[model samples]
Target: MNALSIRSIHGRQIFDSRGMPTVEAEIVLHNGVRASASVPSGASTGRFEACELRDNLAEYHGKGVSSAVNHINTPIQEALVGESCDDQWTLDNKLMVLDGTQNKSKIGANAILAVSLACAKAAAKAYGLELFRYLGGLQANTLPIPMMNILNGGAHAGNNLEIQEFMIVPVGAHSFTEAMKMGTEIYASLRNCLKKKGLSTGIGDEGGYAPDLNGDEEALSLLMEAIQLAGYQPNYDVKIALDAAANEWYKNGHYIFPKLQKKITQSELKGYWEELCQKYPIYSIEDPFAEEDFPGFSELTASLGGSVQIVGDDLFVTNPDRLRQGISSLSGNAVLIKPNQIGTLTETLSTIRLAKEHGYGVILSHRSGETEDTTIADLSVAVNAGQIKTGAPARSERVCKYNRLLKIESLISGSEYPKK
Candidate 1:
């Protein structure tokens, strides 16, 4: 097959739940195949809202978005204008060379993510397989791993800040439908459990009260509660995890540091988390502290590493040098992986391998600003990363990935991929 041609490029708003402009890119291949990808705006109007990296990217959005549009439409487009769509990697690398030094910029990275996703999606369509199947292969299919969320249980919105979010997924369901049914049942049960404890519906932004209702903890809680009510145990077949987003913890000198420190003690903090683990069976915690607090993270990891995984999101930023430092210093035992963090899929995967080599569990995650594209789901399975943390299972943008996984499960009934 000759190189594939790119026909068109455009951007569209996909998610606006939190009021930010998160957008997705649509790219059409020469063969009339359409593919898309989203870049979450990392900007934050509030402390507890979505990841701020997108906001950082926002500063460069115009340039980044334009460059990405051109990257897929320019050199690569020319190289593959009339060629077959096979050999995507070679064409992708050729495009990389055209990008040259500009690739180092955030805009460059955005361009790469958009282009790579479009290419991958095109390839998946060509094979008549789900993107994950193309990326992870049939042999790697396992039970649909369980998932939970952390939306409340923090100091935000008058909540305790003592409890973290979590979810439980059954591992051996026969099909996606069965797994979803189990998830739904678990969510219902959890709702009842919370109601028995006098908790409200826990549906809206005000229901679960984390320090930042708009924060990662709140999102995580919502997901966890949803999973629990569906009739699954948190952290059992359904692995429990949090997306702290580095908001609860702050830099030592941040203006609010003193006030934040006074609200929760180290021992009290440990006790709170310990109790959460005891009651909910949590398996992972991400960005438990401020990004700069490597010592604090190391302490937390060393203290709880035996029973639970400590993950780094802001801590690593998808930089290998930082990851090396993290592993060497024992700052944390896991890393949240995001392609846009470092710009290229290859670079992102390299970080995953490095984390794995160091015994760190890798979690493929989504930004608060997300799109319909679900490439990360496939990336997680392809790399054999243990988990994926998007958001509450309620949102279409978030659940779309889960639903797609279910579709894939339907096609290959007996694959090893986790069922529930």
Candidate 2:
């Protein structure tokens, strides 16, 4: 038997950061090497994202993953137990073929993704290489600049603000460690500012503060003040990024802000974004339009693509086909790569490659519902993704990634931090 051949496969249900059940898969190689991976869930998922199967039973409020866990422990394990885990593409394709579904709804993307990532982790161990080095090869030495989300709204928080995430980008940091220091200071400063205003300093799902601000403008203003309070120069030392998640508020062919009692057309929304970009040190705007509004994305990209990174999260969902469409239509200047969004590491890497081939910036991101899995942290470095949108410096689920990256920085020699 090949030493790299899978000897046993196991699956179990695990609770994520959101207290929701998710699939976790463990792969044991014949050589006695073993690794396990867990899948994360998203609260505000895109319509086009791969299916995350769940039991509709009353258990766990219909967020149970028993069905997905069963698929992994049974049929998926049966097919992959004797297979070699040396080649990620082959193993991942076997999973895709076994399910034989377009969107992985049959076996659940959660199950397939867990097993797929576990296989990769086991293979990396068998080769005696770190996960990042194993996946990215020797040239993968560029550490990504972290886009730490410090404030939350929309579906992610109970705040009145319309934006989903307000992130701080440490643009002037010389290294990944410095970036984390900047992020930590800014995060603390933001908490102080919120408390000073007598606002709720409660944290959201992704570890960002959920304050009831007046609107998006106030949210931006608070972020700016926080940066300044942290002794960072806005736009020079640090910049702002927004995940509008516009799909959350897009209604009846118009965008609505209930807190502001405002409703505006796509064209008007574009003008508003334009004005905000001009007034603020905004470096990136993600999901600026609804997922289905490819035209709106293209128009905004054309208007601000040169100076600002108009990223597509829901518009692409890490699907290469959607990214190809965006590329052809000139929809956005960047793509947010989420492994679960595509159900496999190969597909995720392919999407990153595709984005780079077309000159689009790549950002490895975390789901709103996360686990202590630091796979994305290594992945961000492996691919030199240049940017990562893991949440703030709070919460173990979010901080695990940052901690892993910090360790990697200490271990790897000659690792360069990518220019922000």
Candidate 3:
């Protein structure tokens, strides 16, 4: 292994035809190996209105998007200037150390995560191995799970009901075309089912729900029908999950926990959940209520214990203090791990370990405003997370992560490893 000299680090603003900002980071290796990662800056026009937080940390800190891009480029390039490519761990550790002291509060967690992902990609290419195999051991096969996203109701309720909910069907076959065909079939079935109920077929960023299908039992029932029609068999490899993203709506005196408790009667909520578990075999639910509702979380956990996972994202916010409280109180059974929430890979992994040890499932996730950085893909395999929740495999940015996972699976196809 030759010494790895950081050639140059650069950033550029790429946009979809709609003029949305997708920031790309490029790191050139001394051996002429150039690797890049991109993420949506969440600063695009008309995007913020659809989300809960008007400004992610980039806006909160008053730093421009370029600041984060530069944070990743500068220190990482300097740290790896004369390091060996094979010393990936050592290099990553060194960068983590610098980030801890110098850039602690500058650009927030996104910078460190972006840098780590770029380095991981470069290292994977150097070894001619897929990123996951390089991070985690091989598995007999990759399993596909159903994915659902919180599109409306509560905080993300914009007038336009793009398809906010999603079901991810992982097609690990060698042929991308075949995988896409399967996805299309599943989507068509779901759409037909929704249409039969006179509901909208679009979800996530595609289509909105009907005005009458507000966040109630009726809406959920329609969703259940659509999922079943999509040929999804609950619990037998077809697991169901929901991303509430409810915290976004609680900013201005909305008080989600109490409202959820009041709006959704316990019996009704429990009945719907029971039906979901029995019908679709849902395995996980994220942010069922507002972030601060610890008591409500405990009640839900106690009620639905061992039946499914209750995941916390906005509640924990990557803060160790909150995680400790959640664990002690039995608030939820899982934590959604997003490195950018805490700003460093070291801390993120530490949280994952802590959660696992405390008897909680770890789920690696991507933000709605995401980049092409595939770090979460590797981290999911590395940490053996219970699952990974990126958006549906529709857009290129979202599919890019899934595509990388497929490559990882290919590299370790025949290896005997325990399921993660």
Candidates in order have lDDT scores of 0.58, 0.93, 0.56
- Judged by whole-model lDDT over C-alpha atoms, candidate 3 comes out at 0.56
1-420: candidate 3 lDDT, tens digit per residue: 353555666765455312345456666777888777654432111111111111245543433355556665576566666666455567657765765643345433445555556666776677776666665545424323314342334333443322123343332323333444444455565557667767654544422233335444444555455545666543442344565554543445443233334344434544555565576545666766567777767877887768778888877865566789999999999887766566545567678879978988777776666666777876777666636676655566567766776665555545222231
Which candidate would rank higher by TM-score, 2 or 3?
A: 2
**In candidate 1, what residue range of length 10 has the lowest lDDT sum?**
44-53
Which ten residues in a row are the worst by lDDT in model 3? 44-53
Root-mean-square deviation of each candidate, in angstroms?
5.6, 0.9, 5.9
lDDT by residue (tens digit), candidate 1, 169-270: 355455556656675565566556555656554542212223333333444455566565665555554656554444544444441323234455454555
Alpha-carbon deviation at 305 in model 3, angstroms: 2.4
Q: Where does model 2 exceed 4 Å of error?
A: 258-261
Q: What's the TM for model 3?
A: 0.74
What is candidate 2's lDDT per residue for 282-380, written digit by digit as tens?
Answer: 999999999999999999999999999999999999999999999999999999999998899899999999999999999999999999999999999
Q: How many pairs in model 2 have backbone atoms within 3 A of each other, for residues 3 or more apart or on separate chains, i.e. clashes?
A: 0
Residue 103 local lDDT, model 1: 33
